[model samples]
Target: MTKPIRKAILPVAGLGTRFLPATKAVPKEMLTIVDRPIIQYVVDEARAAGIEHIVFVTGRNKQVIEDHFDVAYELEDTLKARNKTAALDLLEKHRPIPGSTSFTRQQAPLGLGHAIWCARDIIGDEPFAILLPDVIIKSQVSCLKQMVDLYNGTGGNVLAVEEVPDDQTQNYGIVELAEKINENAAHISNMVEKPAPGTAPSNLMITGRYILQPQIFDLLSKQDTGAGGEIQLTDSMLKLMETQPFSSIKFEGRSFDCGSKAGFLSANIAFGLDDPKLASEILPFMREMLDQPEAAE
Candidate 1:
């Protein structure tokens, strides 16, 4: 029987040290790409993928994230009183149904694996999805939805992967293909996290989306520190591989790593250009800046 992936874990406990100063006071997940926060995009993707429950693995000073998804009674009342139908509608559209969202604290700066473990009870006895909040994928269909479709067919662990240049394989968790399932999906025989240069089995790097079974919780519980002395999710996943089959799908989308300044700016521009209301204004401004680098100055 194929288990439905109804819950998703979003590990958002990391301090955004790379984007300090701005991130010093604000949680990076709350940083906005356009009008919506980065985390909103991630949540939207999960919702589109049929996830019924969302588990946010948060840390200190990340209360804003919980608040963002929660109802703002005062704001909504004020909008209603002022007859601001559009604003109220927008809020209603994005607000998760009551009891659909859950938040738990990681309590420390442990790695991604530990953050996820914090939500194990909430995700009890079910296959679930894990979406890294910092990575945003802009696709016609949500990236997680694509993975869910593949998971529904294959009935095992499924990861969203993308082909990277051979030279860049060491920067990612690369997978070794065992059998060619199709043009888009494959049976992964092995996974090497950040393999040394010239030694990567394949260039298909793991993107931030995953559909995993509940047994992974057991593996994560006993996982040791790896790479950075923090419980690494990759380490646990590799161990889980010994018992289960793993598959990958080259999803149709462009992913932006909003964790970095450059990727953040790129996401802003990409999303800005896609917004019908902003595209006409932003595209012209971007072209002007590019065509005449010093004219505006």
Candidate 2:
């Protein structure tokens, strides 16, 4: 039987240069979406997918993330004393079971491929999922769970993908499809990271979610720096495709690119609208913003 994918790697080593001052001291993954940090949403998704091990690839000044996952004993005790059952219950849900989570440091910003490689010791020989915390995906079904379901049947690498406009294909890793496995799935012929406009293989662009076979570690180990003088994950993935079956599953979800200020704000709004308590208050605020002449312009 194929080994079950029980582990996942989250790469959070990037210096959030886009958000500059705010990120100078804070990790971007700790930025709040509504009230929860971005990494919390990623962890929640992994938990929903039955991921038993979460290996975080971190870097300097990211201690807050580690603390966020740990039990806040002082805070919990105070809440308990105050008889705040609901708040205490919420905090408990954020705590991972002891020994189920681990962290490793990525001393340099070598890129996504290198970040994944940092978790090699923890991952050992099993297939694992990789989720980027910068991409907040909201879906009825967890994106990782959806990919895991596909991986079980296909028994190979699977990437979460979504169609982008032809002009925007250059901004993402584009996939070349060989055959249609189904309406929402296809055998990927090849993948190219950020192909120039009009030169892309297909409109389908890769999302942050991935289910990769452990064999990828070998390819990544010897990977030379590609694009931007960094070890790009897409390059190693392309090499792996040459020796194994690879496919892309079009995920059914709404993805928010939280790496940028605009995407971050938009995600906050989108999630706020989905909340029952906040929807009524948020709709009017959004409408007022829309009614402003500057907004129309």
Candidate 3:
């Protein structure tokens, strides 16, 4: 039987330069979309998918993320004293299963592959999931959960993918589709890292969510820098692909690249409309704003 995917590695060490001044002190993952911090949503997605342990690859100024997950005793006590049981209950709901989350440091801004490899010791020998906190993919069912369900049955290596425009394919790692696994999945014969214009095999681009075997660590270790001279995860994954199976789980959902200011603002609005309590008010406000003369420009 395939081992259940119980552990997840979250790479949160990136210096979010796009949001500079705000991120100079605060880690980008701590930025809130509506009420919850960004990483919190990633954690929630993992938990919803039955992930038992969360391994965080962190860096300097990322301490706030650690503190965010730790028990806030004083704050909890204050809420208790003020008779804020519901508020406390909400916090309690989101806390990781006790003793299930661990943190390790990636000392430098090397690359995504290196960040993932930093948690090698913690991940041990099991297959694991990697969640990119900044790429929040929204669906009625969380994207990670969808991938996890598929992983349980497929059992090799699974990546969450979505279609991108032909012109936009150059911005992402495009995969060559060989065969269809199902309506929402396909066998990956090859993957090209940001292929040149008109050379992409298919428009199906690899998005963030990934479930990979522990063997990827070895591949990542020997990976040479690619693209931006950083150890690109795509390079290692391709090497790993020679021996193992790789499939892309097509995710048809709204995805927000929170690494940019515009993307962050878009997520706020998208998620705001998705929220039941806020949607009724937010939708009308958005309609009114869009109808304005200034918005036409």
| Model 3: lDDT to the true structure | 0.90
lDDT of each: 0.93, 0.92, 0.90
Q: Rank the candidates by lDDT, best first.
A: 1, 2, 3
Candidate 2 lDDT at 203 equals 93
Model 1 is weakest, by summed lDDT over 10 consecutive residues, at 288-297
What's the true lDDT of residue 229 in model 3? 86
Q: Model 1 over residues 34-127: C-alpha lDDT tens digits?
A: 9999999999999999999999998899999999998999999999999999999999999999999999999988788888888999999989
lDDT of 3 by residue, 108-177 (tens): 8889999998999999999999999989877778888888888778889999998888999999989998
Off by over 4 Å in 3: none
Decoy 1 TM-score against native = 0.97
Tell me the lDDT of candidate 1.
Answer: 0.93
Q: Itemize residue pairs with steric clashes in candidate 1.
A: none
Number of the top-ranking candidate, with TM-score as the measure: 2
Query: In what order do the candidates fall by TM-score, top score first?
Result: 2, 1, 3
TM-score for each predicted model, relative to the true structure: 0.97, 0.98, 0.96
